[model samples]
Target chain A: MLTQTVRMLGRLGETVVKGVAEMGFAAVLLGEALFWLAMGRRREQPVRLAPIVAEMTEIGLRALPIVTVLAVTIGIMLAIQGIYTLRMFGAESQVVPGIAFSVVREFAPLITGILVAGRSGSALAARLGTMRINQEVDALQVMGISPVRFLVVPPLVAMLVMVPSLSLWSILVALGGAGVYVSSTLDMTFAAYARQCLEMLTLGDLAHGMGKSFIFAVLITLVGVVNGASVSGGAEGVGRMTTRSVVQAISAIVITDMIFVFLVTR
Target chain B: MNGVDRTSSRVAIEVRDLVTHYGERKILKGVSFDILEGEILVIMGGSGSGKSTLLNHLLGLLRPTSGAIRLLGVDITKAPPREMQALRRKMGVAFQGGALFSSMSVGDNIMLPLREHTRLDRKTMEIMARLKMEVVDLAGFENLMPAELSGGMIKRAALARAIVMDPKLLFCDEPSAGLDPVVASSIDDLILRLRDAMGMTIVVVTHELESAFKIADRILVLDKGEIIGLGSVDEIRNSASERIQNLLHRRTEEVELDADAYLRRLTGEE
Candidate 1:
């Protein structure tokens, strides 16, 4: 029984240590990525603009159809829910302002974060993990190319640019959906619904959602790359880490969103 | 004879008393050897015999528990990252399973190191890449993706990429493991041609007795992480070491073990 307890504690300690080591590795990866991005040209190892653009097309543009469909559904649902909920207090007209404010400040970035974490974030992990298994990463190393600079930074740059744009796009599309619903279901014109939304929403409100997505982008990239770089056990390991990348990315984005909200409110 | 003559008898790689461990299990125990410029050193060992571990050490992928490896006059174990990178430009490694990047076409994969490391013109880079493909007999396959290639073709493409920059030191890890005998023989021929034609010092790690004999200027036989024999091919074949004989003859080993010690090791008490 004594040995059992000791073994349990040892396992727990080992987990904690591994977690810390993973974090350290991630921090170093991020640092190297930033360094290469900033100084790569001077050092003759420039983070090529071509790969970043390709990644942007994959991570952002290819995701457009789903983002559009989901945004519209979410907007319509929010309007229907908010209108009925506020009608209990005889404030049905207030639903326009409510939908606009919530979508811009919270829903847009949060939903997009989860969507992207499930989509491109999982792809990044799986791709990198497969490369790791194939020893392609080692091939890069022996050729004197830093694997982080070659593999991670392109997607890093792409994610940093594209996620915020997607969030902003989500905000606009969702508000449009809400406006259509409000115009059809109520006495308010679509123009009036849009006008009310414009009045209620501030530049700061737009920044709040876009800003949160910016942070989420970093979280997603870091989680994916870190899990990828640490993958072992071959094909099974790649699949495991790809799933973990999505889960951990979503959690990190949500927690970071909370922290951002707290600090912004302060 | 371009600058440094390949047959000048200079030591291209010098390993001294290399020691390593994984947890408490000692792997390479005070191993030492040298390879002359343009020579082919075949390191022969079975699985878990520490050849891979030693290769990783030589490549600077894994730091040894102790001792040093010098490649081209710079001690790799203690070299700075910048120096290592510079040294890597003069060295190439063709990994087991032909680790070509799946995302790139054969041409792109071969030219990757040049594109990353050099400031050559696009035309020059393309010409160099094509030249390597031709050298590895993959001239018409440049447009194909790595996934589209057969196993033998992938290995040849990997060899092309490894030698594209004309590295002075080349290492091939299990170059023939998964290929059929015909393909394997071709890979052996390619290794010999690379040495003779390019004058690159080569080290090949394999358990295949026939391939080693065909290509090795010298062979180093390792067993249980120790060098049981190191000599020319004929010398190694004639050596009286039972371990070397067993390895060469593909005989099953009947290891005599002390029961008490074995039990202690199994129980984690020793």
Candidate 2:
């Protein structure tokens, strides 16, 4: 019994140590990526533009349909809930501002981050993980190309440019959904709904959501790249890392979102 | 020539007391050797004999646990990233499985090194890639993806990519592992032709005795993470060592297992 307890504790300690080491490695990788982005510019060695545009199309442009559908659904659900509560005090007009505030300042960025994490993050991990397993990453290294600069930078740049754009698009779609709901259910016009939404949404609110999204974009791409680059074993390993990348990216997005909400709201 | 005469030749790779470990298990145990310039050195080993590990160290992909690896006059074992990159530009590696990027066409794959390292125009790069494809007898197959090619074609395309830059040093891992005898012999012939034509030092890691004997100027035999023999093909074939004889004759080592140990192994008792 004593041996069993000690062994369990030993395993727990090993896991903790491994986790810390992985996090340290990830931090170093992020630092190298940032260094390249900042310093590689002045050296006249910008990462190729073709892959960045391709990645943007994959991660952002292709994600519009799903993001639009999800944002609209969330907006309708929020309107239904908010109206039910507001009508109790004859404050149906308050529903528009309430839904708009939540959608613009919180849900839009959070949902878009999570969705992009599931879509693009998993793809980046699986693709890179396969490359790692196939020894193609080593091939790149032996060819005098830094795998980080070649593989990671394009996706990183794409996410940085596209995630915030997706978030803003989600906000507009959600507002449109809420406006439709307001026009049909209550005695409010779409123009009135738009006016209330605009009044409640300050530049601070937009920045707040976008800032969270930009950070989440960085997190998702880094987590994917790190997990992907570290894959071993075989095809099974690639699958395992892809799953881990998606789960970790979504969890990090949520945790970062919470922290941003706390700090920005305060 | 004797060991002294071989060592006197222009040294391309100088490994001394090289040791490597994967975690707690030592994969290479104090192995030492020299690869002469402009010669094909075949590293022959059975499974799990640290051949791949040593190749990784030579390529500067993995650092050794101890000792040094000097490639083309630079101590790559201790070289920084920039220096390593600069040194790597002078070398090329064709991996065991070809390692071609699946997404790219054969032409694009061959052009990758030139595109990354040289300021050659796209047309020039394409023409150069086509020239290499022709050298490998893979001409007119540039538009196909790696998955679309046969096992031999993929290997030939990978060879084309490796030689696209006309590197000073070339490393090939298991160049004839998964192919028919005819295709394998063609690959062997290609290796010889490339060495003669380009005048580059080549290190090939393979377990195929016929291929090793055919193309190698010297054969280094590795067994259980140690160099058991290093000599010319004739010297290795004429070796009196039972291990060398067994490897050449395809004889398996017999093991006498203790009953208790066997039971323990079967029962997961270690």
Candidate 3:
């Protein structure tokens, strides 16, 4: 039994290592595809253009109002906390720059990615994974359609086009809410706060944040497609993979954000 | 090969010593079969009998462990990507779940293959898709999503998509599964009609005994990864093997269980 357990442990370790290696290769391949997409090769199937439009509306556009409201609420919480801490330190004036940098540079995109991963990413994985496990992928293949080219590519293209837009929207809401808070509570001019945000937050800040969001968006969709493609066992298997996709996507976003922070901030 | 050689000499589909394994357990142990020009071969098996695995192997969806699978006389076991694509253009499969893309309407599902494999214009593809849908008796369902269709409707729609390309070989995995008896019989009729209309070879994997009996020109039954019986339905029924006899007649009624029950009562129920 001891030897069996040791053997099992060794196999588990090998499996994990192999999975990581495969994921690395997949990442390289996906990155190459994305790069080529940027260069040329449109490979767009516009036959389902209407459905793609509807899905984009449902996944990206519909979530905007909710995201805006959530960002405002969180921004207010951040302002209140910043005010209390800065008051104790006699450094209340830093509140504008403090909340502004954090929101525009990090919190806004990260929080929105997490929210969308929970809401949209899981839905994508579950919907696609269910289709996959039920043999819809095979059906597409037999139909001479590439499942990756059809199902995976469109949503990913939608994400690449929409996530940066969503992140920019999130940053605006957060900074706007912070400006309102500073004007009302700290007796500071809204113009001054807004000016500081514009001056302190460079294109670098916004671009870095958008870059992270874009990678996160791609990661979310890739995980969804991969998990969906690899699904087996049955319905319960799909459910489990969907849940894991969401969790893994969120974790991947956070880790990527940290790495981006280190690289950009350094 | 020239186009004439391809047309005259090509054997639609072939399988030789196909084996499939999941993890440690082997499911198909050197299974070999072929769908010749315009033949309908029904693969029958109890659950877990590897019929689906064999079908998947033929479809090039699952690579066999160590065997050759040829489609249209070209060995697809190591076929190049372009060749695989060309081979796929000449065949279609209807999966057990009737796996129509949930996101696409019935018309789109039927149109997808034409769009992928042909240079036909939108108008022509639309007409062809409509024609295929009408063939499957799903003409008005063009606008409906797969989610909106009933089980039998989904199956029929899938069949429509399968034949939309006028494929040389059609693979149907459990075409009658999870359908009403009337619908199952109707689907069998559709298979026959399609065969007659197109002279297309077909391979159907199903365990529904009645459906198998109805449509099969030849039947192959698998038990635990081995072919236990292969012949016409009449031959299978008259098989001398005890397992085949038991399956055909369903011999459970012959057992006398009252002896065990009486003994349990006499022994005061353990």
Candidate 4:
């Protein structure tokens, strides 16, 4: 029994060490990515802008319909739930500011982050994982091209640009959705709802939400690319890495959101 | 073989006591050899004989447990990243599966090395890429993606990509592993042609006896992660080692069984 316990403890230690090592690798990868991008710019041989632009358009445009639908539904749900609960105290006026504050400062960024992580992040991991299995990554290395520079930096740049934009779009659409629902059902005017959102939400709230999305973007890209780059054992490895990338990205977003909320609420 | 290899004893690759391990399992055990300039050296062994591991070591893809690998006069095992990159520009590797980027056309795949490494004009790079395609007999097929091509075509396109930069040292890993006899023979001919035309020092890792005999100026036979034979094909054919002879004759090794031990094993007794 003692030996078994020790063995189990040993396995746990190994897992911890491995996790720490992977995190270190991810940090170093981000540093190398930024360095390579700067170097490429300095040499006037920047990583293809075409791919970065394509990735951005792909992420934002392909996700637009789903993000819109989800945001509107979430906004409407918030209005319905908030009014129903607050009507007990006859505090219906609180619903507008409540929706505005929660949607901007919390729901929009979280929803968009989880969506991007599940959709784009998983795809990124799978693509790079396939490239690894196909030995195209090795071929690039053999040809003196750094795969990190060529395969990674463009997507990293794209995520940094796109995620925050999507977050902003989500915030607006969600607010518009809540305003519509509230104005139609309750005695509130659409303009008054809009005015309450403007009055209640400071620029600090918007920045805070955008900042959270930016971090989430980094987390998703890092998890996807790093998992993809390290994949082994053929096609099965790619599939496993893609799943892990999504899970880790979502978990990272939630944990970061918790921290952000704790700091702000305190 | 005498006239075909115009190699002048220039050691393009020199390995001394190469050793590698995965966790606790030892893979390559003190392998040492020299690949002369402008010659085709075929590394032959059965599955898990460590030829693939050795190839990865030679390519500097894996760090050795111990020993040194000097490629083109640079000790790759100890070379700095900048130096390694400089050395890699002089090397080309065609993997077993061709490994052409699936997203790119064959033409773009061939031109990738040129585009990334050289400041040459796009027109010049295209011409250079086309020239390689013609050399590999893949002319006019450069517009197709890797998935669009047949197996043989993909291998030829990969060869075109490898040779596009005019690398001095070329590595082909199991180049003819999965192909029809006719196509495999053509790939062997292409390897010979590349060596003759470009004066390249080529290292081919393959277990295909027929292809090895066709292209190898020197054959290095590995067994259980150790070098059992390294000589001209004629010398290897006449080798006295039981393993070498067994490999040449395609005969499985026979172990004399002891009845008592067999009975013990059957009875699950120590």
Estimate the TM-score of every prediction: 0.96, 0.96, 0.88, 0.95
Arranged by DockQ, best first: 1, 2, 4, 3
Candidate 1 lDDT, tens digit per residue, A1-266?
Answer: 99889989999999999989988988888899999999988877888989999999999998888888888888999999998999899989889878998899998898888999899999999999999989999999999999989999999999999999999888889999988998999889999998888888889898888889888888899999999988999899999999999999998988888899999989
Worst 10-residue lDDT window for candidate 2 chain B reads B1-10
Residue B62's C-alpha lDDT in candidate 2?
92
lDDT of 2 by residue, A71-115 (tens): 999888889999999999999888987897899889999999999
List model 2 lDDT by residue over B41-104, tens digit each: 9999898989999999999899889999999889998887677867887898999999999999
Fraction of true contacts reproduced, model 3?
A: 0.80
Model 3 - which docking category?
Answer: medium
Error of 1 at A1 (Å): 2.0
When candidate 1 is compared with the true two-chain complex, its DockQ is 0.79
Candidate 1 docking category? Answer: medium
Model 4 misplaced stretches (Cα beyond 4 Å) = A41-45, B2-7, B254-270
- Which DockQ-derived CAPRI band holds candidate 4? medium
> What part of the reference interface contacts, as a 0 to 1 fraction, does candidate 2 reproduce?
0.80
Fnat per candidate, as a fraction, reads 0.80, 0.80, 0.80, 0.74
lDDT of predicted model 3: 0.81
Candidate 3 lDDT over residue span B188-264, tens digit each: 99998888789788899997888988888778888678788877778987889776666566453255568888899
Tens-digit per-residue lDDT, B1-270, candidate 4: 735444457889999999999788999999999988887999999888999999999998899999999999999999998899889889999999999998889999999988888889999998999999999998998788889998888888989889888899999999998899999999999999999889899999999999999899999999989999999988998999999999888888787889999999999765
Each prediction's RMSD over C-alphas, in Å, is: 2.4, 2.1, 5.9, 2.6
Better of 2 and 4 by TM-score: 2
